[model samples]
Target: MELLSALFLVILTFLVVTAFYHKHLMAEIPPGFIQRKKLCFYHYLLNFGFVLAKTSEKLGLASEIHVIRTIMNTVPPLKDKHLFIKDVRFEKIKVRIYQPKIPTTGQRRGVLYFHGGVGQFGSIRAYERTCCYYARKSDSVIVSVGYRLAPEYPYPTQFEDCLAATIHFMRTAEDYGVDPTRVITCGDSSGGTLAAAVAQAMVNRKDLPKLRAQILIYPFLQAVDFNLPSYQQNKTFPILTREQILLLGLKYLNKDVTLLNVLFEGAHIPEDFQLKYQKWLSPDNIPEEFKPRGYKPGKIIHPLSDELHALTMPTFDPVFSPLIAEDTVIAQLPEAFILTCEFDVLRDDGLLYKKRLEDHGIRVTWCHLEQGFHGIVFLAPLGRIVSFQSGNKGIKQIIDFLKSI
Candidate 1:
């Protein structure tokens, strides 16, 4: 009886400490945020889980990512009478394919989806409902790539896996009753980064069937400048923050997290490279309307150390920063559907990429959610408690675009 009481006291102490720390770090929900009350509850629950994961990691019971992935993957797969879902491998990479049950006159469009989690925690299992919804609504086959994540697979592996799976799917698309020529690449957040990179990489390939379109849902496209107007406006917004992005990015790249502050200050980019890319990356390219929240131009506060530049140089590559791709490559790419959220730090990344595509005469469809936040689309299908109307609107916009094409 005494031991049981002692254990209960320890659990209570941990819970109290976790709650206090979460409150300390939690950002205030903007008054205009969609479903502010629901957002608050969801954020707190998420933060509490994160605190538990961190504590578990410190106790050597499990890795933080393992705990988080377990929690996220615990959502039971959605059973839909209108969809047929199966697990398969494309070039040995795990993937879940979702197809409509209803018959069609001809082959349907194919979408290769890569889920977000900054290339760290997301899984095909976690995004089952999302893929099922897309397949049923768009009346298209959806392929959710389960690319190998970081701290195990490391940099370039995620991109390599995504590209490999896409190529394999393009080759075998006919087997699944999908039209190869009409295949699309779509993803959100880091997955958005992969989709953009895959699309850019495929632009010059002559053997593969050309992609019909690419959809990037609030993607992070550049590392050179994190001080864009959206970043300044939404740095403290929940679901995702500027600091979280950089830390996750470093973890994805297997870089030292201590360099995050320097990267945030814009010291990782060399002066010459900055000048060369300024035309495409400069905030001036963003329309004035986006600046109503207020934005000030930022200058590099410190010189780029050679060590820092060498360590962080991969971030500036066009493969990583699709916004920095060459005009020739951009011109040949397929039509694009880019979505941005008003409260997302990466909103300007989508906006800037849209401008680059337009400048190169590529057709682009852009959607901006004034009240939406990052990860809204994925959260929408989770259940009513965390669902937001803006998320449903965003998903509808995507489906409408898919059907139109």
Candidate 2:
């Protein structure tokens, strides 16, 4: 046993060392001229590889997470640059504060950034590059929240952690040289879900200031109808598969997997509920411009048994579907900036939310990445060889919006 344990430790150390070497070498390569398209694929695999590496102990896969952890954190916090980063604790939650290092004549906006990882993976380390970029480019004090993951703490824990952190920051913005009046919540994927949810929840709270805006980057707003156009079009597409998506949802909810088919076919939703959300959740709501890539509306099917529907009803819970928030709640929410990727499965989710926000007369700044795919933003410029123009363009749009508000 002792010899076997020692062998495992040696293998782990070797993997970490080799990964750091690759990342170090990749960083030295010049951007733009590097084989960016190929590097895009590399980062795509690396993102999942990080998960495999950390879970290799339980699933015996491999450990790329250690490699990313080493390199992503290699650029020590640039305390001398545009942002002043300091670790602070509020409401029992830990956060990294990114205040602009340069003096501002008046208070600046604050961005409450939540990192994406499907609620099971990812951390501040994985998002270190993104948060750092925002802090520097937008000249806004950014607070990146490291929320808890799932299959560990179960549902609501991640949401609660983010809510507490965001509210605390809003109430105490003056302390960080930020104007509470202009605070906004921003996130991607699962993080986007949190951003939207928090915005909706705090819209009418007279006790605290209203959110100036919400920036959702292809957020996963609902598990209710997984049959949206983007889901069907990108179901088998690389990065996030349809079946793999269902698996992720189940894992996130800590629910039973025995009746997975019922959830996928839209069975958990009742007839009335489907009819109500259909106005917003259906493919008909998708603009024709998006259909140039080919999207056929899904055929409506009959409802399932009450037992089956009851089992999967949590998908419609406001915690999971912020789109279902009361219209009164929606109307009170602040302005928003939404970005949708053409090849992402969650594209329809963002489109639907945009219409809802707009229908309620809220201002929304929308940006679309015509050729970008799911998780493409994280790969924009992670290393020297793989930054694509589309990814960079999309990222610039985000920074530009932040600067605008």
Candidate 3:
């Protein structure tokens, strides 16, 4: 009788979980998505895992779900016969270096990559396949910086670690057979944030070799206004949602999650500050084609609390939000390669930055992946099960850009 009772309970629990998934998640798929059975199953599993992570956090049994989600994506490194991989420490930060084993005439271009997890979870191991791809395909030396994550190190720590590692690599490029003048900084998601910010921070440094370019892949450039069109259109989108973005931001800042709604309402930023930065961050900067999906203009919200102001002010700084850097800085920034995905919540961030770069007379190569979503690039060639065809196209575009510059 007890065995029969246990079997019945397990079946009932499975049915309940299936019902919840189909009801809440299956209904939220955005229009024009590739409706493959595998794709839907992948998203369903991810949503189910997120739900478990959320329950763990609420029960005080684990860290933030954002970090957990990133951790879940970690996989063992694949063996690359053409690349010589090594792990090293620059100051206190860890980094993985991938060098092509094949012969070259002289020094190769160096790529300094910062992996993205909203500053909390990614590791050098997590980005091994990505760095390997670039090192092998582009024939460049890749240095994947393993910066300290948040909820422990907090804001500015991740930046400092990345900057230190970048400086170390730039200064020691010759030892690694890397051309000092051809080194470029590259990153995706929040790592793109670090790459952009680090590149800007290096502009005035006379000692280090100048960076040849910066490659930003669907970076989250600003936290000042979350009501941008991409945010609205992809609010309920999978993998990275509007709520998850704010949640990750709060986790990075080690701030209260209660501010998510207020920040979404644009209450944290002062009206005057918003007006000042609107020229670059406004919906007007985004091309009209990107808006056919959906977008509503954001209204100014009065400053709410001084506490919220103090907590969120770091986002206004150039180091934190490179998108708001002054015109002069934008003019001096390295030639840029930016990739934006149509279904990404941070798509407009790339669009706005592209406009700013062009306005400053900077050379820009922009690639838009219409069928791609945020984090798709990282899935390239992994498999049709986890990888999108658009991801392969995006990787090819990046490799071509690297070859050009």
Model 3, TM vs. native:
0.94
Poorest 10 consecutive residues of model 3 by lDDT?
64-73
After TM-score superposition, the amount by which residue 57's alpha carbon in candidate 3 deviates from its true location, in angstroms, is 4.6
lDDT of 3 at 277: 95
Residue 227 lDDT, candidate 1, scale 0-100: 92
Models 1 onward score TM values of 0.94, 0.84, 0.94
Model 2 worst lDDT window (10 residues): 28-37
Ranking by lDDT: 1, 3, 2
Per-candidate local distance difference test: 0.89, 0.77, 0.86
In each prediction, how many residue pairs overlap at the backbone (N, C-alpha, C within less than 3 A)? Answer: 0, 2, 0
Task: Give the Cα RMSD of candidate 2.
Answer: 6.6
TM-score of 2: 0.84
Weakest 10 consecutive residues, lDDT, candidate 1? 25-34
User: Which one wins by TM-score: 2 or 3?
Assistant: 3
Return the lDDT, model 3, position 48: 69
Q: In candidate 1, how many Å is residue 376 off?
A: 0.4
- Writing each residue's lDDT as its tens digit, candidate 1 over 1-405 gives 999999999999988976675565444666566477667667777877888999999999999999999999988888889988888888689998898989999999999999998888999999998998889989999999999988788888889999999999999999999999999999999999999999999988889889999999999899889899999988877778889899888888888999898888898888898888999998999999999886888887657678888999889887778889878888899999999999899999999999999988889999888888899989877777667989988999999999987
TM-score of model 1 (CA atoms) = 0.94
